[model samples]
Target: MSGNDIDVYLEPLVDELKQLWDGVETYDANKGTTFKMRAALIWTISDFPRLKNLSGWNTYSGLACPTSKRRCIGEDADQDDSYWKKRSVFFELPYWKDHMLRHNLDVMHIEQNICDNVVFTILNDSVKSKDNLKASKDLQSMGIRPELWPDEGGKYPSAIFTMSNPQKNVFLKTLQNVVFPDGYSSNITRCVDIRKRKLYGLKSHDCHILMEQLLPILVKNALPSPVSTVIANLSSFFRELCGKAVNPMQLGGLSNHVMQILSRVNDQPVDVTNNIGKTMFPEIGKASRAVSHFGLTLMERDQAHRHVLVNCEAVVPFIDTFRTETKRKLWHQTRSPSKIDRVVHAEFSRWFKRKVPMDSTLHSKEMKLLACGPMQARCFRAYNINGYKFRTITKEDGLKTQNSGVYVSSNTSYASMRDNRVAVGSVPYYGNIVDIIELNYSCHFTVVLFKCIWVDTTTSRGIKQYHLDLTSVNFTRPTHTGDREEDEPYILASKAHLVYYVRGEVDQEWSVAVHVKPRDLYDMGGENEKVEAAAFSPQPGLNMSAAGDISDLQLTREDDIEDPIEDVSDNIDDVA
Candidate 1:
C-alpha cells in the first residue's frame, strides 16, 4: 500500500490498540496473546513504506479493495466512508482474534521462561566490568594475598590466623599438624597455600564452620545454664578430643560433630521446672589440657591452706566487735531517707500549695454565677414556647420578663431576675463591654456560663445536655488592648439576661437577668484612668475654696441684675 493509504489504516489500528490496552488488565495472563497481535500489527504498519504505487494500471486503487490482490491501495478510496467502513470491519475481526490467541501464547511463555530469563540477566550483569572491578577491590581490602604462577595467571589467596589469644608454640604446633599431617611431602606448598587461603573457594561454608567452632566457647561464657553444667559440658567436649590432634580438617568437621553431641546432651532427660539441678554434661574420662594449668594453681592454694593453723584466741573478741559496728552502720544507712526522697517531698509540698491554695478566700464558689457587671452588658434572644423558631421582635411588641428563680445557699446568696427582655434572633449576640481587667488585677474573674436544656412541652420530658456543666465551659478574654472588653464596669441601663437554649435547639431559647457582683467586673481601663488623672492633675489648695465661693456670689449677682448688656463690660472682663 502507498504511505498515505497505510497511514490511514494504521492510525485507527494504533488508537484501537491503545484503547484495548487501557480497558483490559494489561498484565493479565490472558492478555499476552493481545501483545503478540499488537506486535504483528506494528510490523505490518512498518512495511507500508516498502509498498510501490502503480499509476497507469491503478494498482493502488485495486489494492484499496484487497479482493483485487494489488500491491498498493489508493488513498482516495481508502478515505471513502463505505470502503473504509468495510476495511475497518475486516481488520477488527482478525485483530481481536489474533490478540486473544497471542495473549494465551504469551501467558504460557512468561510462566515457563521468565524466571530463568531474570536469573540469567542478573548473573550476566553481576559479572560485567564495573562489578568485577568492585569485587577485586573488596577482596584486596580484606587482605586476600594475590598469587601469580606460571600455570595459573593470577588468583587471590585468603589468609588465616588464630583469632583468640594463643600461645606461640601451641598455635605453631596446631598449624603445622593441620597443614602437614603424616609429615611433609611435595604437596606441602599446595596444602599450606590452601590452608592460608582459609576462606577461598568455599567462602560461605568456611564462615559457617568457624561460627560452629566458636559456639561452644560462647555458650560456656554466655549460657544461662547452671555454672556446673556449663563447665561439665566444656570438659566433656575437650575430653573427647584430648588425644586427637586439632587440625583444620577436624575443625571443619566440628560443626556436625558438636551438633550431634549437643542433640544427645539435650535429649538426655531434663526436669523443665528444675533445670538448675539438671546436669548438662556427665563426668568425662579425661581432662582438657588447657584447663589443667588453672586447675593446678587452685590445687596448690588448697594444699597450702590445709597446712596453716588458726590462731583466733586473743583477737577474736576485737574482730567480732568491729564486724558488729560495721553491720550497724550499714543498717542505719539503709533505713535513712535518701536525698532524692527529701527533694521529692519538698517539690510535692510546693506544688500542692500552688495548685490547691491554703487560703479558702482564693477558691471559687461551689456554684458558678454569671452576671452583668459595671463594664458588662447582657444581650439575649427569646424563642416561642411552642414553635422551633425564635420569637421575632416588632416595634409594637411589649417587653417580657424571664426569671431563673432563687438559688439559696448558706455560704452565699444567689438569685437571677430579668426585665425589658426583647426578642432577638437565634444568632449569637455580638456586643462588647467597655472595660476588662487583666487577670493579675482581678481577685476573681466572671465567666459567661452557658447551659443547654432540651424541653419537650408536649410530654413534659426534658433532657439536660450531656456533661453540660459550668466547669467544662471554655472562656477566653480578648488578648489585645484596643478591642473592648466583654467583662467591664458599667451601669445596667436595662436588666441583664441569661440567654440560653437546648443543645442544637438554638431556635427555641429564652433569657433571664442575673445581677453580678462588683468584684466580677474586670475593669482594667477604669483603674488606669484613675492613675493617669492623679498623675497629671494639680495639687488642691484647702484655702482656695472660700475665695472661690466669694467669686461665685459676685458672679450670681451680676447675672440676677441683668440690664441691657454693654458691648464690653467690667463684669465680662472679670469673668475672663
Candidate 2:
C-alpha cells in the first residue's frame, strides 16, 4: 500500500480470498498460498474486517450481498449489520476450533471513537439540534460565537478546522497558556510549532490529549450543569486510562463508567455505549455505535476469553523485519503515534528472563542483544551471583535514558525507584555500582520493567540487600531511621524496589564477596582496620566461611596489582 491508496502489487490475494469466502472444500488445487490458513490474532482496526477482508485503503468485502431483506456485515458493514454473515471467513479460520474470539473491540478503537465524536458533536452540525444548541449556548457563555467558527463541509474535521483565523489565534493563545505536570513544558504544543501540520489529520493520541487536557479547559463552566458534569466525569475515566499506569483505581473507574454506560442498556447484558451516548448526543452515540459494529460488545464478543494474544515478543520482530527489508524509517512525525504501524511493541519480560530461556545464542535473540546499542560502564562493573547478572538497559522509548551514563535520578529522595532511578555515585549504594538487569520492555515507554539490587542498610552486615524486581513497583519502603526534612533521605523501601539474589545459587556452596563490609569503627572498639580484599577483588586462598558473605572479601594478586580504574570481572571467582 502506498500514500496514493493503491494496492501496488500486481498479483493480489484475490484467488485465495475467493476460496475462503466461498467455503469450498479445498483439495489443495484451488488455494495457491503455501499456508491455507494464516492466523489473525487481532482483527480490529479502521476499515479492517475481522473476517476475511482488507483494512485502510483498498478494503474488499467479497461480493457485497446486502439485500433489502438482510444486511450481512460480513460482506457489507465495517460495523454491525442486521444479520451476521455466516458465509464469512470466520468459519475459514483454522484456529477458531481452538476456541478464540475471532473479532473484538480494541480499547484504542473505542476510546478514539468516544474522543472523536465528543469533539465533533459539540463543534459540528452533526448532533441533534437540541444537543447542538446546548453545546453552542455553552460555547457562547465562554465568549465563543458559533458564527465566527468556520463552516465545515458536513464532515466534522478537527475542531481547529471550525475556527476562523482570529478564533484559531485565540484558541492557540489559550492552549499556550495551559500547563502540565512533571517537568514537561507546554511550549512545544504552541500553534507556531504545529503551523506546518494540519490539525484535521490529528491522530487518536492527539485527540486523547485534547479530551483529557484542552477539552476540560475549554468546556469549564461553559456547558449546562448536566452536560458539563457528564462530559467531565466521562472524560476522567478516559483520562486515567491514557497510555499510563493501569492501577486498580483506574480499572475500577473504567468499570464504573462502563456501568453507567450500561445503565442506558437497562439491565440487559449488551453493550449500549452507543445508546447512552446517542441519547445524550445523537452524533456521539452514532460514533460509539460505529465502534460497537466492529464486533459484538466487548463482553459478548469473548465470553470464555477465547483468544490468542500475539504479544510483542512475536509482533516486534515481525514489524522490525518489515521495516528492515522495506528500508522504511520509523514514525517520528508525532509525539507518539499509536496507529497500526507507528506504535512500538515490547514485552514486559526480557529475553533473558529468570523464568524464560536466557540463551541468547539464538540468532534472533543475539540480534536483539546487539540492538541493545551501547553498554554502560556500570555493566562492566556487572556482578552476578552464579548466573543472575545485572540488567542492561538502553533507551526510554526513542529517547536515550542515559545521556552520559545510565539513568540516575536527580530527584533523589522522592524519586520513582522503578522508572530509571537509582542513587548512582552515592556511597553505600552499590558503593557507586549497583548490579542492573536490562528490562526487555522498551519499544514504547508505557512501562519500564527491570531489576536492580541496592545494599539494604537495615542489617549492619550490608549483605542483606533489597530485591527490587518487576513485582515491587508500588511497594513503599518504611520511613528511614532519621529522615526528618522533606528533601532528606526518607527512602521508601517500596521505592527501593530492588531485588536480592534469592534464587539460582546455594548460599552455603557459593558465597561470593561483592564489596567490602561497612564496619563501624565504634563497634570494633578502635581496633586497627585490616584492608585486604578490595571491591570486585577475589581472595586467592583464604575463604572466611565463618564470617558472613562480605567478610570474605578478597582480591586476586593480578587484580590487586592493577589500579581499580576499570570494573573487574571473573577474578572474584577465586573467593577461596
Candidate 3:
C-alpha cells in the first residue's frame, strides 16, 4: 500500500496498543495470582518517505530533517504550511506527543541514498548525475560557483567535481583489475565498463561495499588531491558509522568529520598560491610494489618444504621407489581409491626422506641431498625468479593478469621422424600460480618452485587454439592436483613462462591466454638460465605518466552535453 494508505492499516494496531497501555486484567500463572498488565508502543520504524505515514511528518523534500522546524513550499509564496498531512492515529494515545522519538528512519535506505548520490555524481551518469544543465542553471541563479555556471552560450564547462574521460577510464580500470579474496564480496568488475565509462547494476549491499571499501581506493590518484581527500574522509566516516562495534566516544569526532567533509567538498577554482609546496597533481596509474603482509606458521612452512622436496628433480628416483613400495603394501588391503591416495600423499614423503638417509648404500650427492630434505622454506605472495616476475593469486589484486600466468612444457619421445629418427613432441601445461616458495638445501643452494592450479590442457576437453592464433582454455575442466594422486602441482620457478588470461569475448567459461616476451632480450644460443630469464617482462600498456594539475584534464564532447558542453570529445577520445 502507499504511504497515505498505511494509516488505515495501522489504525487497529494503534487501538490495541492504547487498550493495552490503559492496563488490562491478567493472570500471573507463575505466581498463581491475578495481576494488571500495562504496556505501550514507543516508536515505529520504516524507510525515509514513509515517515509521513507513521508520524504525519512530510519528509519528502530538501527540508525533510525530522529534528528541524522547516515548512514545505506551498502553492503561494506567502503561505507557510508546515508539511503535516494529518495527525497520526497514534497521536490519539494522548502520551504519543510527549515521546521524544515518534518514528525511526531505517539507516539502510539512508546509506544507500548517500552512496548513490556520490557515485553517480562522480561518474557523471547521463540520467543519474546531479550536476546537469539544470543544476548549473540553479548555481547561476543562486549567484554562486561562478565557474560552474553555464556560459553565455548556455554551455556547461567541466566542473571539478565530475571526472573527465581519461580520469574515468583510470578509475574504472583500477576497479576492473581488482581481485578480491574468494567470497569477500561479489564480482564488482561486472558492474564497471572502462570502454563505455559506466557502472550500473549495483545492489544495496554492493553500494555499501563500494562506499565503505572501494571509493577511497579508487579516488586516490584519479581525482584532485583536495577532492580525493574529502571523499576519502567521507568514506571513512561511513565505514566507522556502520562498523560492527562503534565506540560512543568516537561519535563526536565522526560528527566533526562530516562537517569538515561537507565544507571541503564545495568546489573552488584552483588556488595555485595555496598549494605551492604541496603536491598538486597525482601520479596517475603508478601502483605500489609493497610486499605481501600475510605469513605462514612453522607447521605450514615445514609442509611447504616437504611439498617442494617431493617435486624436486633430484628426488624423482626416490619418489618413484616410494610410490612403488606404497602400491605394493596396499595391494591386498582392499582399501578405497580415495583412502589409498590419501595414504600415499600423507606418508610417502615422510617415510622416504627418513628411510633414504639411514640407507648407507645411498652415498651419492643427489641421494644424500634428498635424504636430508629441504631446509626451512620461505614463502612469498610474489617473487622474481628466472628473471620473470611471478605473483600468487592473492598478490594479483591490483595488477594485470600477465605476471600470474604460468606455462610449462614437457617433451615425449615416441614416434619416428621422416628419416626414421626418434621424434619428440612437446606438450604445454597452463595454469596460474597460487603460491611461490623458496627452499634452501643447506648453505650451498636454493630452489624456487611455483605451486599452481592448472586447467586440464587436454586437446578435446580443456584447450583450443583458433586460426587467428588465439588460445583459450576451459577452466571448468579440472586437472589432478599434486595434493592428491599422481600429477604434481608444482614446477621449478625457472621453467615457468608468462602469459595473460583475458576473459573470452564469446564464452564466459573460457579465457584467452596472451603470451609476452622480455623487452630487448634475444637468444644467441646462450646458457639455459639466460634464455629462460629472457622469456618474460612487463607489458607495454602498463607504463604510466603523471599530469600537472586537475585543470589539465579535458572536458567531455559537445554532443555529450544535453545543453552545450565544451567541444573536446576529440581530445578526450585521444587520451582514452
Q: Would you estimate the TM-scores of all the predictions?
A: 0.11, 0.27, 0.39
In angstroms, the error of model 3 at 208 is 1.6
Among all candidates shown, the one with the greatest lDDT = 3
Per-residue CA lDDT of model 3 for 1-576, tens digit only, reads 666777788889888888888888899999999888989987888777777777666676534555433333223356345556666788778588677677887877777788888888988898999889999999999687677889788889877868988889888999889898888889889998777899989888778888899998998878998688888888889899999999998876676467446645653111111212322111111112553333544454445556566555444445555666567678898454454545655676677656556343323434455457665556676666445667778776876555888887766311111112222468677898887766556644556667788877644477887756567887786564544434456677767888778886678889988877743467568456443444332443443345468886667664654665677989899999
lDDT by candidate, in order shown: 0.27, 0.34, 0.67
Between candidates 2 and 3, name the one with more favorable lDDT. Answer: 3
Please identify which of the two predictions, 1 or 3, would achieve the higher TM-score against the true structure.
3
Q: Per-residue lDDT tens digits of candidate 2, residues 1-576?
A: 232222233124444544564455535556654444432334433322322232221223322222212232333446554233234333344443343333444566567667666655554324422234445455556454444333443322233224344444454455556677765433435423235212344466666667676666655533444454556666776777765677875564476465454332221121222122221111110010111111222321121011111122222333443333233334344332222122221221222132123342222332333234212111122322211222222322364321111112222221222222233343233211222222121221111112232233222344333332111111123222122211112121112221232222443422222322222323454468776765442543334344557756665554456555754455566553
Off by over 4 Å in 3: 1-40, 47-53, 56-64, 68-86, 93-95, 151-155, 267-576
Best by TM-score: 3
Tell me how candidate 2 scores on lDDT: 0.34
Off by over 4 Å in 2: 1-86, 125-173, 179-199, 247-253, 259-576
Q: Please rank every candidate by TM-score, starting with the best.
A: 3, 2, 1
Tell me model 1's lDDT, rounded to 2 decimals.
Answer: 0.27
Relative to the true structure, candidate 1 has a C-alpha RMSD (angstroms) of: 40.7
